[model samples]
Target: MQTDIEVYVLSCPTENIITWLEASFTLVKKSTSGPLCSKLTLLWQGNEVEVTILEQAAGKRFTSIWFDSDKTPWEDDITCAKQVFKALDCEVRCNFQGWEEEGNQDPDLWWRINHHGEGPFIWN
Candidate 1:
């Protein structure tokens, strides 16, 4: 049920990704004032991939981590996800009192980590 890392996705736009892609991006999901977004099917490398913007903590929470990484959207979503989460974390760190591990520093951390749940990059 496993496969290679999904690339060419709408990644969360982590700072690292911003540095990598050298482009600025944003999440187009329900958490914001944008149009309600539904899970969309996209073609990457001629492969069909499933993509969704995961929402957490009720309406106050929102994130589009691009669930599948073995497809095109994976790269775009995760990269963007990383950046968006990082940005969100940077801002909420002071107001939110909790130890949320920022994205890993290792380039292959997401792929190398021993996943206990769903995938290789679940972190814990």
Candidate 2:
């Protein structure tokens, strides 16, 4: 199973993201990495998970949440995306399937969860 998780949310405020992270995980440290990015270090299940929040990642619409560790709780990006959507009550997007270097995959295809529903769609 995949350990790391990366997802994207559309039109979400940075403060809301921090609030959700603080409520869900034990926040260890928070730092402003750049004008449009923030770095967060969190502890989950006794493992350190580094998260990077990047605004305007997709043409000024989507913000990327990158969990840079294999110790994330979820199995994959889609699972993490669902949890994030439920917590933030916003639109979340993730890759349709786990990455496979030698396997055929459509990079534009993504699984999206929003207020309306969840489904697969071409992102770009």
Candidate 3:
């Protein structure tokens, strides 16, 4: 299982993200450092998870949600993306496979989930 989770969604509002977080986890604290970024501290399964939401992350239409902690519910970014897509009812994206600093991974390959379905695509 992954120690952290990070995924991107298309055009999701910050308020909606907070609402989903509040409903899914025990929110400890929330702070908006700027208009485009927000940080959330949450507790899940007796673990502290730090989540960061960054707007306009990809081409001004996508937002990044990064869960920095061990013991996150999902095993990898793709799994996490699926959950986010379902909860937020928006398009979500993640690397096609687990990322490694020195691994020979194709950067353009990505897993995407949306209202239509979920699949792998060459993200450009």
Candidate 4:
């Protein structure tokens, strides 16, 4: 099974997002076959797990993170997800399968999927 998540930014993104991400994790490989993207593997519970900046659009960015439902703690996985939000420093909508819907008080961290024509969504 594959676990995936997405973060969308409505405002223009800056280099700080990438800078912060690189600073937080280890980048193993960059994709040579598709759009400009990278492969990152992070150490969780003493094991290396694969994560990737699977998609990048003008205002929409998607991260592909994998977790074993039987073994990996959701807390650990979500902590990694929070890093993406921290790096962007802007309003972001997070979409990941399996979590119950709960409203947010902060506009900077939205959990629903709503997009305007301000920027590319990376994937169609």
Candidate 5:
């Protein structure tokens, strides 16, 4: 048995660190690979959150998406998925481990998967 949950993708991310990233990031955006700076993994409570830059600075507009943590709620007006990131008071490092593991497993087994990629959901 495995416990799976709804995955959410946040749009138009407005993190305060955007200014730093914009000023310091120098890598050119690639069509497929994109820039390394544009990718990141936001982990909280052992759950995986994929945050990727969807668009570049368009006249001061910076946009990104947060996937896998913004949709679900674990407490009264508090989301368990985002709690860890907030507590750390920092940015998360980008890693493909979580996405690779989930992709290896059946795409539908999402519910059985944990943020740590430890899951193989058993079906009835």
Candidate 6:
């Protein structure tokens, strides 16, 4: 079974995405030891969480994102993630299906953010 989680998928350039992520959490170490792309280890919930920055295909200019953290107070991470979206002025496709497994439908919904202005622009 998966832990109760919220995954935020974003589309943005490398530098801007890194900037937003750095602002959201304390940077523990940046590992250029990876072959594909540099990985970032960040501090969240008093623990280290890893995030991979993947470059999208040509003509797309979008980036893929992922993170790992403990269960307690995941909401704090959610709030921080949203702040990154807003800071980057980028759209986000988010799913909280883990909430569904726990019979908590509130976070199980899907939403999209379009940055026409300062907003999440989330819709069901």
Tens digit per residue, CA lDDT, model 5, 1-124: 1122222222334444343333433323322246423554444445554445454432233233333344222331113224423433332222112344345644433222224533334322
- Per-residue C-alpha lDDT of model 3 across residues 60-101, encoded as one tens digit per residue: 999999999867889899988988988999999998977787
lDDT of 4 by residue, 1-124 (tens): 2243344444423345446545655544334336645455554455555544444553344333333232233443334345555556454444433343574434333343333312213232
Q: State every prediction's TM-score relative to the real structure.
A: 0.31, 0.95, 0.95, 0.44, 0.27, 0.60
Per-candidate clash tally: 25, 0, 0, 0, 2, 0
Instruction: List where candidate 5 sits over 4 angstroms from the true fold.
Output: 1-32, 35-37, 57-60, 69-124
In candidate 2, residue 14 scores what lDDT? 89
Model 3 scores worst on lDDT over the 10 consecutive residues at: 1-10
Per-candidate local distance difference test: 0.32, 0.91, 0.91, 0.43, 0.34, 0.56
Q: Worst 10-residue stretch by lDDT in candidate 4?
A: 115-124
Q: After superposition, how far is residue 80 of candidate 2 from its true place, in Å?
A: 0.7
The true-versus-predicted C-alpha distance at residue 53 of model 5, in Å, is: 2.3
Distance (Å) between predicted and true CA of 33, model 6? 6.3
Q: How many backbone clashes does candidate 3 have?
A: 0
Query: Model 2: clashing residue pairs?
Result: none
Error of 6 at 113 (Å): 0.7
Cα RMSD of all models vs. native, in order, equals 12.4, 1.0, 1.0, 8.4, 13.3, 5.2
Report the C-alpha displacement of residue 23, candidate 3, in angstroms.
Answer: 0.5
Question: What pairs collide in candidate 6?
Answer: none
